[model samples]
Structure formats: structure tokens, C-alpha cells
Target: METTKRGKVPLYLWMLLGFAAGLGGGLYVNLTGQVVIPEVMEIIRSVGQIFLRLLFMLVLPLLFSALAVGVAEMGDLKSLGRVGYKTLLFTVMVSAIAVGIGLGMVNVFRPGDGVDPLLAQQLLAQGAEGASAIVGSAPQSIEAGQFFLDMIPSNVVTAASENQILPVMVFALIFGIGMVMAKSRATDQLQETLQGVFEVMMKLINLVIKLAPIAIAALMFNLAAVFGWDLLVRLGAYALVAVGAMAIHMFIVYPLLVWIFGGMNPLKFAAGVKEPFVVAFSTASSNATLPIAIKAAEENLKLPKRISRFVLTVGATANQNGTALFEGVTVLFLAQFFGIELSVGQQLIVMLVCILGGIGTAGVPAGSLPVIALILVMVGVPAEGIGLILGVDRFLDMCRTTLNVTGDLVAATVVSRGETDAVVPVDEPLPAVAPPD
Candidate 1:
């Protein structure tokens, strides 16, 4: 709710300062081998965790309200279907491109070829010790049939309470269709009420977002304190490959999509979405960054409210271009590290699974780790090899999340340009819908 004045410092600059401070402070602690470093990290970790929790607390309400209202406002089920198809198609196309870029880069770099065997062994052992903590008891494998069935929640309230986004999304879509079919005074009032709640949730998110710089500082400081420079040095090659792949996707793939599909200047698109990118990079959670993305699309990009809300809210859960790329490269890298050669056919399967996994994976920090482990096991690579990359995952996560959020905005822009009318100004109120007599 707080507004920045003309003369005062901008929020992104503060976040950048936080990042620099955390990096410098963490390096000092790591280099000095300070006896009190652990204690300091614990305090910072607690504060960072609290900030993360605050952001997550708004996710479900914001998602439900935004998605449900957006769907209902489409005026009919057919329009909603058209938009849904376009959105899904765009998400799949972009995600596949990301995976391809990652696969090519990792293969060319061959980062796993020279890993020290002893270091690999140590990392494997550490992975075994911490695997339970990372995934919280291995998930029971579910049949594909059951997985699809489970996506349709029998009880919407239960799904929402559990933060089961996919199922909650299904419910919202169905509920919105029902609203469209049975339009009445009651439905109109309900739609209005939901819109008000959505706006309130956005306001709450704005307030919570102010804590980002501090939280980012704490998170990065803890990461550096715990992992230190030695781990980074050891994993530097793999880190470079992953970061480079993401850079290519962000700079090349997305810009092209924006220019060709949206017909907008790519640099202007990037500038419009800068605030969300910074938050996504710092927070490393697309869901937490959803409200901010919506704000950017509507306010900065002047996208239609319906298009921005629907695309971005759904994209938060489904369109993880960055995660898909990271997972694909990671699986191949681990296979190489363990001297396991994946046949072309096997690698193709890995690619497919990475694309699907990106959709199912949660949009939070380290959310893809378990999926990466599972994919490794599927491809005959040791699941424990996950530890080899865990050391650098946090840093890569920051980079990839920026791409994920950016991809969402790009998808929204392209889809909106194709399907909607002229862009609406942010300050103007949405037109009222008349209740059926």
C-alpha cells in the first residue's frame, strides 16, 4: 500500500542493495570462518522463513479470486475454452523450447566430465543424509489414471486448504462456467464480492512485498554461509552451463516470441516487467510473485484485466519454462557425472518428462528437486546424484525463476493481443455486468 515518491530511492534498487549486502556479508563470514556464523545464519534464516510464509499465505486466496473472476467474466464457456486452448498451447511451445536450449547447452559444455570422483562420492553421501529432508518421505508412486482423476477435486474447500493448485484450478474453472450458465442477481453479487476480495489480497501482497529485500538478503546470506565458496568452485562449471542456458532462453527465445507474437518491442516488454522479475529472482517463487506479475501486466503493460489475470494465475502453476530447462540439463549432467550414457531414445524420454514435470512441479524454491531425482531414477541414473547439483541449485533457482515469471508475462501479452480488444488502463474501473432478470 505504500507508494514510492519521485525523489526517494526505488524498490528494485533496495532489493539490489540487499543482494549485494548479503553476498558481501556471507563471503566475509565464510572466509573468516567466524565462530558466530552459524548463529547469525539461524537468525537470518528465521526471518527469511517468516517472510516466505507471509507471501505464501496470500497465494491461494489470490489465485482463487483472480482465476475464478477472470473465468466468469469471459461471458460464456466457449470464450473461456478458446482462451484456455491458446494459453496451454503457448505454455507448451515455450517450455519445449526452453528444454531444448538446456539440453543443447549441457551437452556442448559437458560440465560433468571432469568432476572429482571423491567429491561426487561425498556429495552422494550428503544427498542420502538429506534426501528425506528435501522431499519429506518419498512420494508413493501413483498411476497415471489416478493422477488425472485426483486433479479433479471432490471437495474444492479441501483442495484450496491443502494448496493443491491444479485441483483448485479445476474447481474454479467449473464454478465459473456454472456462474456463466446460471446468471442471476445472486451470481452478479458473488462476482462483485470475489473481485473485491481479489483486490484486497493484491493489496496485502503489495504490503508483504516490501519485505523482499530484507528476506532476499537473509536467504542469500544463509546460502553463502552454509555452502561457502568451495562448493561453488567445485560446481562452477555446472552452474555456468545452467545459468548460460537460462540466459539464452530469456534473451533470445522470449524476446523473439514477444516481437513476433505480441508485435511489441522486446526491450520495452522487458522494461515493463522489471519489477516482477526482480521480485521473482529474489524470492525464487513464482506463486509468491504472481500478484506482482498481474500488477505489471495490467498497470505497466496495459494488458486487459481478464487476459492478464487468467494467463498469469494459471501460468504460476503450469508454465515453468525455467524449471523444465533446469531439470532437463540436470538429469543429463548427473548421468554424465556418474558415467552413465543415456541413449538418444532415453534422453528423449527425459525431455518429455521434464516438460510434464515442469507443469506438475510447485513454483517454489527447490520445488523441482524431487522431480529431478525421480527422473534420474527413471533413466537409470542414481537418484542420489541430486546432491551433486544441490550446492548450486539455489543460485540457479534465482536465475530460472526470473525466466518463469517473464515467460508468463510474454504468454499473456501474446494471447491478449490475439484474443482481446484494446488494452485497458489500470485506473479505470471494470464495467459492471447486468444481472439476469
Candidate 2:
């Protein structure tokens, strides 16, 4: 009971903290000339980078255990197909909506094109790196020839063991559906062992979550120290519009989605996810928070255990409306910044690519950027635009993570309710027990 009260940190307190620190620190750096210290900046960057790397390291093991357990426990072939179809369809449609929001925002606000030409050139020139990592750039090097075929995993064990979510999902999914075909005795036994192990791993990850505040504080500070406060204001109008659109999507649109589809009170659901919001804000990784979000839906909403389990595990990979939103907005912003007039064909590409990209994004840190770089190339946006955003990506990441996890929760809730139950398919039906021997 007491725990709930502590969760409500007054909004003004946080605003003040952000304001005072940003205002004071900006003045100090500009006054003392200490912002450019080579050694100090390096240490700051190293700390944040280390934390970011550690957060990503948790993805494979977490997914493996969660997906394996989620699928094995149910062993329900019928529900598996139904659930998978709903998840994929929802992800695609919502992702397109997110792209539309981005298009609307950048077009209205025109954040990028407003930058002075010289600053635009210099921003492009700064210690910029491509947004993508090696593994994330599928649109370019992946070759459009075999996109669908590549999604089907040839080797189940290799895929899961390697943490390839698309293939791992394919494998775990088929194995669960097949295993459910076995007699009840076998499925029951398999589920018992997997659940036991998964619980233990979850506890360990919780400890890692405790480390997140420290990591995030260091990360935010480090970023502020190097970029200087001016970076936040570089394209102030553009950032505001993007952030504002994300806010409307998260607070207004997502909640409305929940009410319309799930018939649940949006305020209660939001209140329930407060802890997740904080974690999502700090850690900025939906893949990392899958376990927590599932637990919240199960515990707070009293959702059927299996319902939260399967829906959320799958949602972590497939449902990413917030990410779709970010990718769309960022792409358009870059086009505007470079004064590149996007033809109708180019805008269409952004819309389609972002929708797919949001779905394809792995549930890990910095996972979306590489894919963004690939999309830039597809639409003829200079790839170097990626490096331009890296400086602020760390900060923007916090906001995006909140939306991603929140959207998953909303999707899970809605999915648990079938047409009979208001179309929320987020909860699980009680497991059937074996007949008396």
C-alpha cells in the first residue's frame, strides 16, 4: 500500500530538477570553459556507453527465457495463430499511423529546413556516426529479393541461441504449437520446468534494473556535458514538435485506443504502469522491460496469466508504434534539414519503410538507428544525417522507450479481450486441468 504513494513523484519536482541543472550547468560550461576537457568528456562517455551496452546485453537471455516459457506453457496451437495474427496486423496498421503522424508534424512545423545552412553543414560534419549498427541495416544490404524468406528461420536452436527474435519467434512459435499436440502430460511437465527457470532469471534481471537509475543518471549527465545545453535548442522548434506529437500519441491517442477497444479506464492503466514509465524513461529499452510490463498487466489488471505472458512477449518484438512514430519523424526532419524536397514517391517510401522498420526493430538499445540509416539510403536521404542525430539520440531515447512499452501494454490489454469480451485479447483464459485419473 505504502509503495504506491511513493511512486508519485510530484511533476514539478522533476521539472525543477531538469531546469535548474540544465540552466546552471549550461552557464557554468560556457563561463568556465571546462566543457571541452578531453579526459573528463571521455570518462563521461565511457560510463554511459558501458551502461548502454549492459542494458542491451540483457535482451537475448530475457527473450529466450520469456518467449520459450510463454510459448511452452500455453502449448495452445489455436491461440498461437490467433494471437500472432492479431499482433502482426495491429503492429502494421498502427505503425502506418505513426508514420502519418510524423509526416503531419514535420510538414506543419518544418523543423529541419529552418536551420541555418552553415550550422546544418557543421552538424552533419560533427563527430557524427551512422545511426545503424552492422546487424540492423537489412533494407540496404539485405537485398529486397529475399525479405520474406529470410524471416523464416531454417534452424530453430541456432536462432534462439543467437537471440535472433524474428527467427527465434518463428522457432519457439512452431515448437510450442507442435508440442501442444502432445498429450497433456508431456506439455504440463515441459511447462513446469521452463517456468521455474524463467522465474529465477527474472529475479536476476530485476537486480539489473536496480542498476538502471545509476546508469541513466550517468548517461544523461554525460550527454549534457559534451553536447552542451545549446544542442537541445539547436532546432528547438523541431524538437518540440516531434516531442509534442509523441506526447499526444502516448497520452491521448494510446489511451483512447485502450478505451475504445479494451473498454478499460485509461487513467487506471496509466497509473498502473507508472513504474514502467520511470524505467522506460531512464533505461530506454522496451525489450528490457518486457518482463516488468507483463508482470504489471498480470498483477495490476489481474489479467489471465497466460494472456499477459504470450501477448507481451510477442508485442515486445512485433508491436512498436512509438518506434514507428520516431522513425517517421526523424526521416522527414532530415529531409527538411538538407533542403531535399521529398517527392510523393519519397514520402511514400518513408511511410512504408517506417511501418516495416518499426515492426522489424529488435527489442534492444540503439537497434532502430541502423535500420533508419538503411531507410535514408532507400529514399535518397544522405546517410550522414544519421550521425547528425546521434548526439541527441541518447536523450530522445528515454521518451521513445516510454511510448514503446506503453503501446505494448495497451495492445496486450486490447488483444486479451476477444470480440465477446470487447476485443481486448490481452488476458489469458484460465488453464484447463487434466481429468481425474
Candidate 3:
């Protein structure tokens, strides 16, 4: 529940300081060809690993509690009624498109490729020792039949033990659906318990994130020291691709959905949702921006309150097209960076997980990091490569958060289409209610 700002010094200012120090130090070593002290570099690497291990330690519990609670909270689809189904359908379809756009952009541009060959080899060599176990255990090639079959998991505990993330996720989802069906006092308690677990995990993750400034310094220094200016170029390319993919989804995809499905003019929709867009970008937290989005839907867009509330509220958490797209792009970019080749089936697996991840990922700053890290490990990419992106993530976070909020409003507007309820009148005075004695 803590804002990104903590105490007198904001978390972002600290993060920026860490980024600057690391970048400066790394560039010095790179340009001068002076070797960093071995002991100091080792300490830096250890610090980075500590951070990653902390995240790795909590990944399963976090994933389970978040995904399960998220699904259960949706309530029974039958109970959710017509609007629920429509919102769910729109969320899935639109999130898929967003991921598709990101994957396509990465594959076509291959930004992860075109790095200096020697630099790529050095990165591979550095990561190979730590990554060997994961890389070795990964399937030599993904087969369509086996891939689908393995999703069920012969034993959920065993799947979690082996880091078979997809199977674990499947189990969590089924578990959630089971809670939804039971619908008793015990089930309600179970839901609350899971919700409690999720809140705790979010707190723990945020605490870990507090160390991110140090972690970012270590991570950026490592990359910059070795890769030199090429690191910046590749990082720039990645940020560009991420922003571009999001832009496509926001400007092109959302508008098309609003026009075709919602029967609203695209230009009008864009103008009406501008306030929410700015709020989302500035805050980079969907949950924080929810009130603004609701207001925009009701006031500027003149959407029905009932539909807008339901869709926008759920969309704030469940309908994160932007997060899903970013996850896909980061995974592929890292895979490419590490010289790992994921086949078509594997990429499809990434896309599927991303769609699920979008639903489960916390609506907070840097929330997508845990999911992206796990996906990289799931597919044999080195997890440490996440460091390369963290320094630049705030900007990307802002960009995608805007997309997330905009997507929510668009869903609200689209879902409101043809509802018999009258739109809220702009500038209408509130009806006075008598105070209770």
C-alpha cells in the first residue's frame, strides 16, 4: 500500500542515482579498457544475485496466491452475468493482440540481435555457469502434443519443485475456479486467506524492490562494464520497440475495438480518455489511477455507471494488455541477448503465459518484473539479464501504465455500448442525502 515515494527521499530518486552511478562507472571501465578490481566486481555480482534469489524464492507462492485469488475474485461467470462475459472476452482477445504485436515487433526487428558478436559471446560465457542447470533441463525442442499434455501436471507439488511454471499456473487457476464453484463459508475463508497471502507477497516484493537502487547499480555496472556503448544501443533499441508496440496497441488496436465493438467514434474516444491516460502515465500504478479512469468514463465518455464501474474496476486488475505485451517483449529480448533460440512453439508458450500473467501481475510499479524473470527461466534464458532492463524500466513503466489505463476506459466504453441505462449527465449536481441521526 506504500506509494513509490517513501519518507523524505522518493524511491525513484534513489533508483535514478543508482542508475547514474552504475552507468558512469561502467562507461569509465569500458572506454578506458581498465579492468575493475576483481573483489569489488565479485561483490557487485553477489549483490545482484542476492536480489534475484530473493525474487526467485518467493516466485511460486506469489504466483499461486496472486493467480488463484485473481481468478476466484472474478466470481462465477454465470453470476457475473452478460457484462462479465463480455468484459472477459474483450480482455482475453485484446491482451492476446497486444502480446502478438510485441512478439511480432521483437521478431521482426530482432533488436536483441545485431549486437557485437564478441560481446554476445562474453555475455553467454558469463551467464553459462549459473544458467547451465536451467538451460540443460529445458526441453531440447518443444513438441505441440507434449507441451499441451504437460500443462496438466502429474503432481502439482512436483511441478513446483521442478520449476515447471506453466503447470503450476494451471494448478493455481484450477484451484481458483474450484473455490469459485464451492461458494461456502469455508470457501470464502479460503478466498480471504489467499487474498491475505497475496497482500503479504506484494509487501515482501515491494520491500525487495526497495533494494532495487543498489541492485540496479550492480546490474547496470556489470552490463556496461562488459558491453560498453553497445549496451546502451541495445537497451535503447529495446525501449523503442517496447514503446512502439504499446503505441500500436493503444492508438491502433484500442481505437479499432472502440469503433467496431463499442460503436463509438475513435477520435471521440481518444479525446474523452485523455485525462485517464495522463494519470496512468504519471502514476504508473493502475490501482492508483482507477478513480480517475472511472470519472473519465462517466463524465467525458458519458458511459453508464453500472457498466463502467464493473469493467473499469476489473480492468484495473485483470485487463492489462500493456503488461502482457511488455512481458513478451522483455522475454524475447533477453532470450536473444543470451543467444538462446526459442522455437515457434516456445514463443507461443511465452505468449500464452503472458496472457495469464497479465491477469495475475500486480498493478504496481515494476510489477511485471517477477513474471518476466520467471518466464525467462521457464524458457532457459538467463534471469540476470533482467538487470539490463531495470535501469530503463521506469520510463517503460510509465508508457505501459498509460496503455493499461487507456485500455480500461476503452473496455468501459465498449462494454457500455447498447446498455439501456442512461449515461451520467456531465456536470450534474449530486442528489442530497439526509444525514442519519
Model 1: lDDT equals 0.70
Best by TM-score: 3
Candidate 2 positional error at 191, Å: 20
Better-scoring candidate (TM-score), 2 or 3: 3
Question: After best superposition, candidate 1 residue 250: deviation in angstroms?
Answer: 0.2
Put down candidate 2 lDDT per residue, 140-208, tens digits, no spaces. 223354644655778766654543444554454455545656637776787666556546555554544
lDDT of 3 by residue, 1-437 (tens): 22553456767778878988888898999999997788998899788778877877777788888778777765445444577767767887899999999999999998888667787678667665655544234443566588888789999998888877788888988898798778788988998998888888888888898988898898888888878888888889999999999999988998899999999999998898888888788878899899988998888889988788888887888888999999999999988876778899889889988988888786645768778877887787777788888878888888888888898888888878888464445689777999999
| Between candidates 1 and 2, the lDDT winner | 1
The sequence of per-residue lDDT tens digits that candidate 1 reaches over residues 1-437 is 12246898755556657766766776677688876645665677666656645644665566566556655654444445577767767876888999999999888887777655654454345334433332222212345467557658888887666555456656765676677778788998998998788778767766666676786677556545544564345357788899999999999988999999998899889999999999998877788899999999999998888878988987886688999999999999877775567776566667766675566454433556545765665555545454446445557878888888999999999988856655556799999999999
By lDDT, highest first, what's the ranking? 3, 1, 2
Instruction: Please estimate how well model 3 matches the true structure, expressed as its whole-model Cα lDDT.
Output: 0.82
Model 3: how far is 251 from its true place, Å?
Answer: 0.7
Off by over 4 Å in 3: 1-7, 77-79, 132-140, 420-437
Q: Which candidate, 1 or 3, would have the higher lDDT against the true structure? A: 3
